[model samples]
Target: MTVTDFDFICQILRQRSGLVLGNDKAYLLESRLLPVARKYKLASFEDLVRLIRVKSDEAVIKDVVEAMTTNESFFFRDTKPFDQFKQIVLPTLMAARPNKQIRIWSAAASSGQECYSLAMILSEMAAQLSGWKIEILGTDLSTEILDRAREGIYSQFEAQRGLPINLLVKYFTQVGDRWQINQKIRSMVQYKEFNLLNDPRSLGKFDVVFCRNVLIYFDQPTKAKILNNIAGLMPNDGYLFLGGAETVLGITDKFQLLAGQRGVYGLTTGQAAPATKPAAPGALRA
Candidate 1:
């Protein structure tokens, strides 16, 4: 990757996916995207970068972006959070919205792990949820990842990460070397391409939004913008979950911190109702 082309690609990625890449990350890019290069039959990273810039090839760009997006997740990744969701969040939502209809958005649903995991959770409680309208929409910025997500297949190694043995046996079948998620579980969620930096109006509202492990890539301004944009798409009393390390305070004042949790935040009682903020700031400035 030449310095000029690298900078150009980095700028475009930063704009499109909020990925902050610097010159020093050239090696990281090579290490992470070389598989992409191999899969696409490009001879080298230089060849991949050349095709990306000169041709402005959308497929190649999608491959590069998909290669860079973080997909670190597992079934029931964090134990306590799921416990909180089942014990507290679901009950609150059921009471708050008597219709039993709930919409969940996994903002950076890389390869669909998080969304599928949540689907499994909901399915286990399906008996009590028979009357509800449940919709799970998972969105990522990468076309390549979304394709894999739609397939709902995982290798033994991939399935081993955070998946429990019992659930694995029940929800998957061994095909060749990889473990495939069952069709019933796979069909529970809808995957789509969504750039958080872009307008989110048409994506609709959600009762709970899972946007974990992706915010650190954004600069503070971009982080605030993404946060505020997500808050806007959430119901007033809706719940928002960030990565355990992420926070809404000091970044954006749109969400009030939950009583006893660090990463969990929610809108004020009447804030999400025909809401108006301090004239919502710019993405970077928000």
Candidate 2:
């Protein structure tokens, strides 16, 4: 691809998905978009670029953006975050929420592992949250991945990643060589296609947000904008979990690191809650 073609694609990705692609990633564009070109019956990569530039086809653009975005995820990735969710976030939210309801959002929820992992944790604590309404919403920019997440199927390798033996036995059933999460666990979460660059207020308030491992690809200003928009969707005492490599420091003042917690954050004092909290959609009664 020429310099013009590479820059154009990078700009579209950044604008649509808040992803920052450097000049070094030209190889990535070629590798990831080549299949997209073949799928569309385009003759060559240049044809794909021409289709994008001249026709400005929305479908092609969407595919290009989704293709470039990474969807790397695994069950209970990085044990500490899930541990913190179970031990800290849950207990605090349970005590504070008088309605016995909690909503969780898994941003960039690739293939639904993160959402199901949380569902399994809630299922294990069913006795404690017997009558509570718990909702888990998993959102990704790619509709294709969200479909896979809703299906809740995983390869043997996927099922084994950070998934404990007992929980695996308890929650999944083997189908051929792959595993599918039980319907009960699958029903506990909902998946939707969402972009971080857009406003999140429409999704309603979330008690906890697991936006782990997503911001490393964006520039500082994009990171700050996304963080602020997320802050708008959270209550003052709400919890935010970022990737181990990501942080809110210097990005935005809307949130502050939770004391003694490495990757957890809470809204700053000056951050104001929405006038009225909207009810979360598709809540499951536990």
Candidate 3:
């Protein structure tokens, strides 16, 4: 590709998804945008660029951002964070709030795995959470993915990839070669289409927000903007979950990292913090 075409792609991606594109990432542009180009019957990347530059079509813009987003995720990814939530967060929340409801949001809940995993986690401990209204809302930018999420169907391969055998037997049923998530677990979560850049007034508030792995693709400014936006929707004592390598220390002062849990952080209301940020983040894969 020519320097001009590469630069054009970089500009478009940065504007739409806040994903920074160095010249070295031209291959990434080609890989992600190739299908879009082909679908539009554009002969070349330059042709796609011409259409984008001259037309400013909203469909092209949406397709571009959707094409670039990384949708890799699984149930109970990395394991540790869920364990911590069960051992620490849940107990503390139960004790402190007592009878109050707990609300959680899985912000980048691609294909519904993470949110369902959370449902299973809570369902297992539902006895402790009785008289408390527990709700989990999962949102993604892609409507097709949300539809699949609502259907709660998964291929045998997809189901076995990250799910433990025991949980698999208990929570899923064999439908041909695929496993469909149980109705009870499916009922525990709600799915919606959301754009993080858009206003979040209708999202209400969340006690815990899991927006992991996706931020690494965003530029620093976009990352800060999203972090601040999410923080605004959360209460002062809420919890924020980032990817294993992602941190709030350098990105935004609105959140303080929790000690001992690498991907977990606490929101401090005033001068006081609930728990310390994790000192070392364990190697986690999403």
Best model per TM-score: 2
Worst 10 residues of 1 by lDDT: 277-286
Q: How well does candidate 2 score on lDDT at residue 209?
A: 95
Say which prediction, candidate 2 or candidate 3, comes out ahead on lDDT. 2
On residues 1-286, what C-alpha lDDT tens digit does candidate 1 reach at each position?
A: 6787678768878876889986799888788878888888988887877777678877777777877877776766666556556656776788788777999999989888888888888888889888988899999887778898998888788887777777788888998999889999999999999888888879999888888888988889999998888878887788888888788768998887666655567886532322112122221111
Question: How well is each residue in 166-265 modelled by candidate 2, as lDDT tens digits?
Answer: 8889999999999999999999999888898888888999989999999999999988988898988888789899999999888898898877677888
Q: In model 2, what are the clashing residue pairs, if there are any?
A: none
Residue 224 in candidate 1 has what lDDT? 93
User: Candidate 3, residues 23-138: lDDT per residue as tens digits?
Assistant: 78888888888888898999877778889889989898788877776678788787777766766667766666655888898987889999988898888777877788888999
Using alpha carbons, what is the TM-score of model 3?
0.88
- Global lDDT of each candidate: 0.79, 0.87, 0.80
Instruction: Kindly report which residue stretches of model 2 are placed more than 4 angstroms away from their true locations once superposed.
Output: 270-286
lDDT comparing candidate 1 with the true structure? 0.79
Between 1 and 2, whose TM-score is larger? 2
